[model samples]
Target: MDEISLLEQGVSFVLHIDQHLFALVAEYGAWLYAFLFLIVFCETGLVVTPFLPGDSLLFAAGTVAGAGHLSYPLCMAVLLGAAVLGDAVNYEIGRHVGPSIFSRETRFLNKQHLLKAHAFYERHGGKAIILARFIPIVRTFAPFVAGIALMSPVKFLSFNITGAILWVAGLVSAGYFLGNIPVVKNNFSVVIYGIIIVSVLPVVIEFIRANLKK
Candidate 1:
């Protein structure tokens, strides 16, 4: 097996890579936190890449904090900033790129999706961006979709701020609290596994419903 492919190794493999750099991440904890945040931000912010492990990573990081390796408050702060900044950047990208989507020659991009995002924007309006924080892949796609539809910038920011705070605070706190349980402490991997499964449920349900309706 190859030693360094995300495909071959999966999340555990990636965490091993994170562990290798744990010492360095710990040395400049804030920077490390920000670095992880950016990745999460980009993953959520970019429509092309909505598969990042925002939930699992946050939970695992919180668990790490519970063990005294990382500071919980700092971890929360960094991840929150990452979550918020990610949305903001993604919103800007959408705002700028929306018109280009109008061109006929755009490859692999669908105008219908932009329309759909707009529809979603209308139904849920701004809160979708913020509420989307709880769901895994959707959180990433929401902003991009919103931007593609040219959602109002001020409205996006309002929900984005609310969602960022709630999203980050909720997940971090979940880990901090549950992670300290005796069973959870001993079975961190099990907990993380469950988190991953739960995180993906929203996407799965939507996928199934979409197919079923057709």
Candidate 2:
């Protein structure tokens, strides 16, 4: 599909995840678990697929679990595993590709993003791995940059595991607890949009700050 079409579909999916999620679970049954795993994996694992819905998807999954359509434990486990393993694979790819590939801009990957990820890594140290988990685009690029920078494998894995647990479990739990509230449930589309805005807010602020500096 074209870029605009893909963008529209992504927006629709995020806004209506609550509506579609239960139907998917019911129709796919246990396979839905594997599907979610793949979604989470591709979102983090592939640089070009960074635009995939990660945060909203997790929240929707948790909401489904809250409604008793799926097991919370199983959902969390599969998602958590996908997230950590995804980062691991991404890091390895970056390590293998080295930093040279990022020297030039591409249709899918931007050199400026790599620079930002590098600066983020430098400023935050290993903690960037954890912090990036909460950010949108940065979350996808952080591990790859970490590998390109040749961060110690041991330290990277430690932060990766910790971040995955906190990110996956924390967001999922938030949805489980807050999603069922009458107000939240009634306006979940708004909540999903809010989540998207909040997730990207940091990047927006950073961009503005950089422009001001320039």
Best by TM-score: 2
- C-alpha lDDT of all candidate models, in order: 0.70, 0.89
The alpha-carbon lDDT assigned to residue 68 of candidate 2 equals 89
**Tens digits of per-residue lDDT for model 1, 81-104:** 788788888888877876676666
Over all chains combined, what TM-score does candidate 1 have?
0.78
Consecutive 10-residue window with the lowest summed lDDT within model 1:
13-22
State how far residue 80 of model 2 sits from its true place (Å): 0.6
Candidate 1, residue 43: the lDDT equals 68
Q: What is the C-alpha RMSD of each candidate to the true structure, in Å?
A: 3.6, 1.5
Q: 53, model 2: CA deviation in Å?
A: 0.6
TM-score of each: 0.78, 0.94
Determine the C-alpha RMSD for candidate 2 after optimal superposition of all C-alphas.
Answer: 1.5
Give a tens-digit lDDT track for model 2, residues 1-214.
8999988887888899987888998898889899899999998888778788899999989998998888999999999999999999989988988477766667778667677888888888899999999998789889998899898999999999999999999989988888888999999999999998999998899889989999
lDDT of 2 at 132: 95
What's the residue-level lDDT of 189 in candidate 2? 95
